[model samples]
Target: RKPKTLLAGVSGRARPGRVLAIMGPSGSGKTTLLNSLAAQMDKAPGLVLQGEVYVNGEICNQSMASMRKGYVRQEDTFYSQMTVRETLRFVARLKLSPEVPYEDKMAVVESLIKKFSLAKCADTIIG
Candidate 1:
């Protein structure tokens, strides 16, 4: 069971500390590409993967540790009962280093909101 490689000869550079977006019309293989990049898909029958995927100059393999590169899908899932700040605090608690303080986490959250152009909608709670 392997995932298919959907793109070939695609090249682009995302500079460090820059925001990136993946935009396209419906059925444009955006999720497929993201799945392959994240290597987070569940095993399924009849899937065939070709070519290679490298993250931070390392090929994707079983031994690779949990990848930290942020890849947010278009329709992300979140709990309905949590406030925006609570949800973000939970996420930050899970992702940020243990030594990072609450203020640093809040700063990271604010920066991510600005980075994602989600400032205006940051306070909105998910339903």
Candidate 2:
């Protein structure tokens, strides 16, 4: 068995006040690259991920990146019993700062629903 190279010579910079979109066809390693950058990539036998990743001009490792960033996959794996709004509220509570008021947090969740046009299904169960 030989180790496969999922990514090689991949380099890019994401600067403040700008957007960096990773676009590609399916199975084009977009997820792999994001996982590596977010330090969420799992270590598997015979899988070698070698690269230097930096955040805000400093070298980023798992601990450092985990502290400063969050990653969400493109799939919805929320609790099937929870409604869309409920799921968003749950996530907002976990991710938002403690100083953020409950009302504000809920407001944030509402904004997300509207932003993504999920209001129609906001109260619908994920199931």
Candidate 3:
């Protein structure tokens, strides 16, 4: 059985200080592409993924093993007792470079909250 191709001939680059989005209609492989790029795609029967993904110009396969990547699903899940800010902070600490200063990490978390308009419920717990 051959699994249908979710993505084909897709190539692009995401550089520092720039934001790139993978947008398309539903069932258009946006999530597949992101999972492949992050090397976090689930290994499913008959699902063959063949492509090259590069991060910072390094091949994903070669570097993903040692790299720390983050993937936020469309439906995010978090501890019901933790506030949004707390959840973000926890993820930032775990995913961000160890050398990144605490203040800088907090800054990034704050920026994300603002960018996503989560400020209104930043302190709300997930339920």
Candidate 4:
């Protein structure tokens, strides 16, 4: 079987204190590139994934990328009936490692709430 290349020759810069958005039509490998950069891409048979990710000017491997970076999907897949905190907790439970204790996950959720300045709306329902 022939191997398919999902992304190649893709390069860009992301400066701190700024927002970087990857925009493209559907099936253009935006998610693929993001997963590769965030080290979240799952391995598949015959998949030859090769790339170097750098954060804060230092080269990072998969584990390093996991620790230093986070990815928020472009779509709004959360339930509108859930409050802000509920939504965050739900996602945290899904994304954080299973070995992470419940208390720890909640702590991380709280940290994210504060970091993103969502405390005021923590209990506000998404309408």
Candidate 4 lDDT tens digits, 59-94: 785567657555796677889999999999999999
lDDT of 4 at 91: 97
Give the C-alpha lDDT of model 2.
Answer: 0.83
Error of 1 at 65 (Å): 5.7
**Highest TM-score, which number?**
4
lDDT of each: 0.71, 0.83, 0.80, 0.83
Model 3, residue 4: displacement in angstroms?
1.3
- Model 4: pairs clashing at backbone N, Cα or C within 3 Å: none
Q: What ranges in model 2 sit over 4 Å off?
A: 43-46, 79-82, 85-127
Name the lDDT value of residue 125 in candidate 1.
79
Q: Per lDDT, what order, best first?
A: 2, 4, 3, 1
Best-to-worst ranking by TM-score: 4, 2, 3, 1
State the lDDT at 111 in candidate 3.
Answer: 100
Per-model TM-score versus the true fold: 0.49, 0.56, 0.54, 0.63
lDDT per residue, candidate 2, 47-123, as tens digits? 55686887767787667765755457877669999999999999999999999999999999999999999989999
Q: How do the residues 21-61 of candidate 3 rate in per-residue lDDT, one tens digit apiece?
A: 77899989887788677665673344567766666676666
In model 4, which regions exceed 4 Å deviation? 43-47, 54-59, 62-67, 75-77, 88-117
The list of candidate 1 runs beyond 4 A from truth reads 1-5, 43-46, 56-58, 61-65, 79-127
Measured over all alpha carbons after superposition, the RMSD of each candidate to the real structure, in angstroms, is 7.4, 6.7, 7.8, 4.5
